[model samples]
Target: MRFAISIPQFYADGEFDPAAFRAYFARAEALGCYESAWAQEMTLSASPQLSPLEAMTYAAACTSTLRLGCVVFVTTLHSPVHLAKSLATLDQLSGGRLEVGVGTGGPQRPFAAFGVDRSRYLARFTEGLALTKALWTRDSVTFDGEFWQLKDARMEPKPAQKPYPRLWFGASGDGALRRAVRLGDGFFGAGSSSTAAFAAQVSVVREALAAAGRPAAEFPIAKRIYIGIDSDAARARQRVNAALAGIYGRRVPAIEEAAVAGTVADCVAAARAVAAAGAELILFTPLYEVPEHAGQIAAEIIPQLG
Candidate 1:
């Protein structure tokens, strides 16, 4: 199984430690278990978190071989032109080591705050995705889109990766999973989904690919799993719950239940279930005590997986 780790984002005001952050990547690279490092996006949140692109750029500078990306940018809330330009620039800056993940950000998001029409966000998402890809690959683009339009537009300095970077979709429902198969290079299961639910989603993705006459082997599948490791299982559970609550702004029982926490053996068993559920790439995201969890997971859990 391919293993990846979440790049550290949790920070307090005036508490950003450059040395520690750089050290985290350095250590992960030295361990030789991680193929990539990922960041998550939350444009408007109660938590103080760095922007995914900025964090990813910093990570790219710190580590040479580790691929960097964001799990899902709320595409509906963004200006496609600006977002596309930024991602293309990031891909170039990272020397083509970029994977783009996007989603509609759900109906619950504060759409009005971002000037998004809640009812028509999905259309905006799909159109925006098309526009972004066009900007990346097209030399001069002329397009008429409902949300955006361009006439003979030229985007210089194309991405380092040919045909642009890989696009991964963060989706849950059957319809969205099918769209992932239709439009994205991969499907990324959310951290909030239970193992059974994730497995079901994977089934839908595979079926969609089959119906589309696309080979499943060409489209990768990945999942972000909230995880923690501690000998005292109860403590691990408590820590993960508290962390999720802080991130989500409330207590979500489903999210708490979905997290993997406890001893090394317990985590191994849970990760095995994820692999069995069809997650070729498992992104281990520790919400609290990140460095310690990263170290232990790389040293203990990854070896056990192999």
Candidate 2:
């Protein structure tokens, strides 16, 4: 199974130091612990945040072999032509090591701010995805669609990767799952997802792939997982809970249950279970209190698995 690390660039307290983040990536690269690194996207949110694309672009410059990705980009917020060109530029700058993850977007306020009709978000998302993919593959294309229309439009500087970089879709509910299966090259789900829920989602993706006459192996499956590693399981739990509570403005009971905690062996076993459940890659999202826990995982859990 492939392993990756996700940095939470958002925080409720304290300023984010770019130098420290660069150091973190340096350490992670030196250890050879991760195949890729990813960042979360949140626009117009009530917290200190860094732009995911900008951070990933910086990371691409800092590391040589590690692939960089944004967990999910809100496609409904931007015009397809502008987004396609921007992503193509990012792919070229990153040396073809970019994976674009798209979502329909959530929350009414952000859509309102962007002047996107909340009721037509799904339709816009679908049309935008088609347009972006077309732009990546073809030279000049004309399309007439419900949300957008173009006449002989062309996008220059195609992605460095052949055909285009991989596209992953983030899904939560049944409708979202169907949409992802219909268009996405891969699937993404929340870190707090249960084993049964993950299994169901995987089954849906696999069946969809088969129905579409595509090989299952053609697409990679990635899931975000919250992790807190310490010698004491209780201490690990406490650290994760504190971070979640601080961010959400209330205690989150699900955080304690969803997080992978305890000793190195315990965390490894949990990772194995996730792999067995069909996740090819797990993006571990750790709380700020124990950011070094990733180092511990690299030193201990990875060795055991290897």
Candidate 3:
């Protein structure tokens, strides 16, 4: 199993220290402990978080070998053309070390706040995905869809990765999992999901791939896991629950239960369960004490995982 880490995004106003951030990536890359670094996007949330793309761009500049990505952009809320252009630029800027993750952002999201019609958001998401791929792969695109239209529109300096960077779909539902099999290069399970939930999603993904005649080896499956390592399991659990509550704007018992906490052994057991759930690439996200979490995971956790 491959291991990844989350790029910290929860910094308050004037709290971001560029030097510290650079050191984090540099150390991570130097140790070769992480294969990729990911960010999460949550716009209009009560918590303070950086924009995923911007955070990713900063990360790209800090580490040469570590692939940078956003776990899932709420694509339904974005303009397809603009999103495509931005990703293509980021791919070039990162020297092709870019992974794109997109999703519908769920039913609870305030779609109207983003000027999206709740009923048609799914159509917008599907069509937008198609448009983005066309822009990345073709010299010029011409298309007429229910939500958008383009005529001989050209996007220059196509993504640094030939045929575009890997597109990962963030999905939990069976229908969405099947769609990922047809449209995305990989399936990414949410950090908020439990190991059991992720396992069920993986089963659906595998079944969908088999039905589509797609090779399982070609489609990577991954999950982002919220983790905290502390000698006192109770303290770790308390801290994790508090941090997640702050980030999610409410306390969720399921998410708290899903998080990995406690001593190194405890974390290892949790991560092992996730691996058994079918995460080819597991993104270990430490919610609090980000720097210390990185060091501990690199020195203690990664060695045990293999």
Better of 2 and 3 by lDDT: 3
**Winner by lDDT:** 3
Global lDDT of each model? 0.91, 0.80, 0.93
Question: What TM-score against the true fold does each predicted structure earn?
Answer: 0.99, 0.91, 0.99
Model 2 lDDT per residue over 215-274, tens place:
888888988878888888888877777776655556767655767767777888987777
> Residue 260: error of model 1 in Å?
0.7
Model 1, span 1-306: residue lDDT tens: 898999988887998999999999999899888999999999777788888989999999998899998999888889989989988898899899998899988888899998888899899999999999999999999989998989999997888899989999999988899989899999999999999999999999999999999989899999999998888999999999989988888899998999998989999999999999999999999988898888899888888877
lDDT of 3 by residue, 93-167 (tens): 999999999999988889988889998988999999999999999888999999899999999989999999999
- In model 1, the worst 10-residue window by lDDT is 42-51
Ranking by lDDT: 3, 1, 2
Q: Model 1: clashing residue pairs?
A: none
lDDT of 2 at 173: 73
Which residue runs does candidate 3 get wrong by more than 4 Å? none
